[model samples]
Target: MHDLLRDSPSSSPRGSPYGPGDWAELEEVARAGNFDVLRSVTYNRVWITGQSYCRNRASIDSCERHLQSLWYVYYQCARHVSHESFEQDRWVLDIIRTRGRGPLTRPAPGGGIDIARTPEGTVWNDLPFLATDMTEYWINSCAEMDSKQRINAASFLAKLASTRIANDRLCQIALDLFRDTFESERPLGSSNEADDENEDRHRTIHGLTIASLLPSACAWIREAGHNIILLSDASWNDCSHSTIGTGGFTFVQSELGQRAPGGFSPWRWLYWLKRLHQIAEEASKADEKLLAEQAANAIDIMLSDVKERNSQILRVFEGAGDAVTQDKDFMGLKRKW
Candidate 1:
């Protein structure tokens, strides 16, 4: 999806450290979702990338704003879901109402011209990162989700944060927020009449959900072209408890962390999925000791799945010989989460 990045990121946003051409290319590619034909961008990665590009079009608050959006997408794939039960839901909606409502070009009423809106009736931004199609995709997809599914979505979101250990303040904030909002011991906030929806203990519910399932969610996103890297969440001792609190463990034979063969298997995801459900039930009990134990068990499951997936990835380049570089990045991640 980021083939543009495979080379360089052009036309990202005004005042961006990246060249205009590089960020622009990313915008076009994401908006098109391909190079050969036209298609709307689908997930949080592309959608938020575009949103940040336009919001900071003026270069005011550019660096911080742009970086923040990038980290959000790097951490979460989808925008706020339909179930905005927690304060996080309200924050997400505030963004969606403004940034997710229309294309980057859509004009404001009464000839109001802004970075995101103009008198010409809202033509695509210079970056064209945000589009109605992507917004619609989010809305339509989220609309079908019920409370149960949303709980699962919450868990998936946590895993996204856990996998990639971004060394940034925003990433830390997101991780902390996820942990706080999901902890079951924290009683649900009282309902506010002004709020859209009132659900008791929204964060606790989502937090519990987050503790269960990792490998399956990682597999699903990977197959969809979203690669979740493995990093030790506990690497930064500044943080609270270990990633074990999330019930996602990293236990596997690393030698297989190399490349993969041809045609990977989706069927293997079923095994991880079943295990995720089991862990989810355990997480719901809110027993710290039990969750930690399950996390250790989950490590075994994750290790097995990661080994096979990595093997499959490397297999694809088997016939390429020594044409590739010797860089660590070129070899991809040496460890699995």
Candidate 2:
């Protein structure tokens, strides 16, 4: 079942390079009646508390728009990550010039068709859900990209928040997840490693991850500034103290860590976090006191960015692909979002 969810453009590093052996493990998992893996494979997104849509356009309708838009925006953000992963997967495979003796399959440039473009039931199985299947695909496809491409791609995902998303909270989360993806896990049961060596490894990977996530964080905050002002002016009188934006600030600080003076590398990760803090601080200075619902809308945007980033990173780490699939029980067995 999880294997079913794993199939996507990102699932193949260079293309849909699956052979007979590729499906062997998945078939065994299926035969063992472990369909429950499906649930565990699902990604997390913050669901709106309200069940039904609000009808009143004045206050309630606005809230509905905010919530719905946030969800859609998050979906779009996920799509961006997935699209980037698919592209990177193909790019990495295309440029791969392996000289050693290996049975690695390679795809011609643009020869491998995207599942999105291929007819269903022909090249693959049923199309999986966009949110989970495709997102996981991005994660798996990360292995296909070389280190340089991975770094650049990760940074690109971080920067996504700035372009149209402009949601700082979301961007910060993306960075965090990306940072986490680069880390190698110690054997689950064993914890004996040289401290210096471990520290060096963390610093090296963390630096790259931080560098990737920060610029995007700054971009997200900068882009959202105008929206914050506009929303503030639009909801001057009716704004409640619990607006989504207010909650978003709290969420950002809590999830991404606060921006204190002289903490960690500002150029990589901490700098963007500081920028996010500054954006939130500026939002607080609006002319009118923000309504709880109104603020919540802004908060939703931020949270969604974080969620999207996290999703992308998860896809990069735990999703399918030849590179990440080297040790199924090692990297593949880990429970990622």
lDDT of every predicted structure (CA atoms): 0.32, 0.29
- List runs of model 2 lying over 4 Å from the truth: 1-128, 137-147, 151-209, 215-337
Model 1 spans with C-alpha error above 4 angstroms: 1-165, 168-234, 238-299, 302-337
Write candidate 2's Cα lDDT for 241-299 as tens digits.
12211222233343233322111122123223333333334334532223222333434
State how far residue 165 of model 2 sits from its true place (Å). Answer: 12
Considering every candidate listed, which one attains the maximal lDDT? Answer: 1
lDDT of 1 at 329: 24
Cα displacement (Å) at residue 294, model 2:
30
User: Poorest 10 consecutive residues of model 2 by lDDT?
Assistant: 119-128
Poorest 10 consecutive residues of model 1 by lDDT?
Answer: 247-256
Compute the lDDT of residue 323 as modeled in candidate 1. Answer: 40
lDDT of 1 by residue, 1-337 (tens): 4433432233342333545564455444533424221112223333444555554343323433343333233212232222234533433333334433455432334676544433212322221222222222222332233333433344434433333322211123222322233222333222121221322333332332332323223323332222221212112222222341231111111112122211122212222233344444555555545444544454444445445556432332333345432322224213434
TM-score of 1: 0.26
